[model samples]
Target: MNWNQALFPQAGPLRVVQGEARREEPSFFPPTHLELQLQGAPDAYGIETTVSIYPLAALLQKYPEQTEGSVGQQVKALRSLLENPAPLNTAAAFRLPAIDTVNASLAVAGARKSLSSANLRGVRYLGAFSQDVRRFASTDVRYVFQGISRDGRYLVTVNGSFSGNVLPTRESLEGSGYDVAPQPQDNDKDRARYEGEVNTYFAGVNSTLDQSNSNPEVTRLDQFVELLQLR
Candidate 1:
């Protein structure tokens, strides 16, 4: 019962089949989408007011006649809309000049619609690749690539640091055309500068986080405890 010979029959000291080559993809992932809606502005005298995306949409739908408001106010309003979600109908209600510019940028950047099922006429969603980058850059996010052997498995982890206070480290491998190894100083002085930027981003976003003791670290610890209990 020579099982090895039976499985891979080749006489005269055959070669062992090892790693499989990866299939080449037709295209890479699409870019992330960023649709911003700016609204609000000051009056002739200098009074300013603003509204959320939903409310702004309502205002736009309700009051299409008033377009000669403050430019600054409109910009602020549009920026707010991009962060917050509003109903499609609400978003359609108001028309702003910023949409054309933003959409133009999106087109140039190769951004795509979020959904394949329904129509996304006025909403904005980032591409899968962009979303992935954002998720990793959010806050202390880490990436782990896992592989297995017959006897054991191993994990390769890339721990992301904070940039700008609360934001996660962000990097892009696109547009360079090829991969290049970093120089030694590129790993230290440059790395330090990047980490510093992350610290700043996080600091700004920390205020926006839920005002609870339930930070990411706390959540991760809870998960670890639960896994331990299961074991």
Candidate 2:
């Protein structure tokens, strides 16, 4: 289906690094959620970042206080709660400041509750220049995500470049008025490689989700085996 091509028609060549899917079981993690990690691919925009997806239901369960308002309101409330030190446990391995970084990234994307049932539920994106380009000038690239799927079970994120001195703070990367240029190093070979990789990842996700009673732990193992067999 050329998901990337369909999603980001204007985007240049993409490289897939590490694609992993894991189910979060209830234990000490607080809320149970599905986590999908799409890593690698330094886009033509000179942006390098990983895409992470989390279910909104789990997030609300973890922070019941933030669940009272609309999706946008919830996001805002959670942002405020995560930023403060009082809500975070000092003894816990998870640091408030680190979580604040993630929350800050989500804020940069301006994820909010959806007003319409057909619309996206929430999103949050943030990025900075690579270490090599940090000193001279900033290229102003940002990664973004959209909450597709009705249940808010699937959140898709990607890396791309945007215009203006300020980084992208929009809900959707598409139609965000970003100027994307093709990479000088990209060729037909790279394009084909990216398409296959993307397809494989999505196929695995669909297959895993189709099962009525899917064991996330076992599914992860099976996925790893399938990936190994493919190679």
Candidate 3:
């Protein structure tokens, strides 16, 4: 796979690491992968940008979204979610990949939500997530585009971490419309209510990520993926 470097983060030097990709937990089998990083940012900034591509079988759980099925069925199901998303769909949340290992639960690792396609490959899910949702520790909030190849053999993800875009937090939720209570609610009912606000926040984040430098308003990452070719 050859990617366009110009589509990557332009702020600093882009670090390229190409080789096998691992899962959250070590596996006897290793999958081929490529990772692109933007250096010179603080820990809070996280990976300014990352692109991960790997074979579907590399994961301990082969299903794209941890669903039980054959590879074709799983790919169909994952693609269906992006194609026929529910109201304010967050399906992309289930598809985040573990950068280091193939056996991680990407769905629950961080707080994430997504809107419909941002358009690249067959599907480009415009997604948002926190590096550490429970702690709200990092200033970095990621906007990602995840998809599979037309032939259904690969899973590719492009992610960018931007600062100061934390979604609603327990403390911040004090007066965050969904929970105007003097103190944020701690019960399951509050969680149900807050779900709407969380999705709404991701929608806004998607809009911001949709824009990019230079003319025509297309994100460089999107532009880069536009030219992505895998053999």
Candidate 4:
């Protein structure tokens, strides 16, 4: 079941990032990954991953017509969402096709990161938008759930972070004063920055999913799925 409409009533963006932001405010883990690395030696033995709900604009861009069985060719498929000013896709509405595409993408992407929902134990969808940019005042709402692995093991963890932005698009982000245009960099500074921001947001959502403060936030910038696991 989809949680977008059910959890987000006041504003799409707020509802999207609320839960995730709360988790990330202190850098996801209570003590932060750096502390964990120094204290628990997690780097010696621990895996982390993160998962987030696609923004409405991203959904529209990637799955405009609900095409299936293929990756790429979707709307806004990796475009700079933070700086773009594209209109939100609230009118297009989230559909099964889009959801399917997202799930498929998740499955493939998750596998690449050594994670999958088949091992999902539970999930809490967190909204992300402009409102909770700081998350000083808000409530965390739980949305969506899938049974854990029959072996009594939570194969994967999922945090449902949403970008409360009505429909995140390139035009929308650019209007918001974010540097989202594509560029070339051998050092990949722009790519590094983008990954950092995305990871930061994703950590927020994952931290919430591990509400009790059990799982550790990821250390490596690339291992987002470290906050997410799939059996």
Regions more than 4 Å wrong, model 3: 9-32, 38-43, 60-77, 82-138, 163-218
Give the candidate order by descending lDDT.
3, 2, 4, 1
Cα deviation at 10, candidate 4, in Å, is 20
lDDT of 3 at 114: 34
User: Which residue pairs in candidate 3 have backbone atoms (N, alpha carbon, C) closer than 3 angstroms, thus clashing?
Assistant: 22-100, 22-101, 22-102, 23-101, 23-102, 24-101, 24-102
Per-model lDDT: 0.24, 0.31, 0.46, 0.27
lDDT of 1 by residue, 105-168 (tens): 1100111111111111122221111111122233222111111111211111111111112322
Q: Compared with the true structure, what per-residue lDDT tens digits does model 2 show for residues 1-231?
A: 022333223433333434333234211232333332333334444444333344555544554452223233445543443344243222111111122122222111211111112323323222232222111112443333333344445433333332223233333344443323222247888777656654453333223222311234223322222221100
Q: RMSD of each candidate? A: 26.7, 19.9, 7.4, 18.6
Off by over 4 Å in 4: 1-124, 127-142, 148-174, 177-184, 188-190, 204-231
* Winner by TM-score: 3
Of 1 and 3, the candidate ahead on TM-score is 3
On residues 1-231, what C-alpha lDDT tens digit does candidate 4 reach at each position? 122232223212212223222232212211111101111112322222122333333323332343442222222221212123232211111210112123222200110111123323222222222321222112222121122332432222233322121223444455564432334366778778766765564455444433422222221211232232322
Q: Candidate 1, 119: how far from true, in Å?
A: 47
Candidate 2 TM-score to native = 0.30
Q: Model 3 reaches what TM-score against the true structure?
A: 0.51
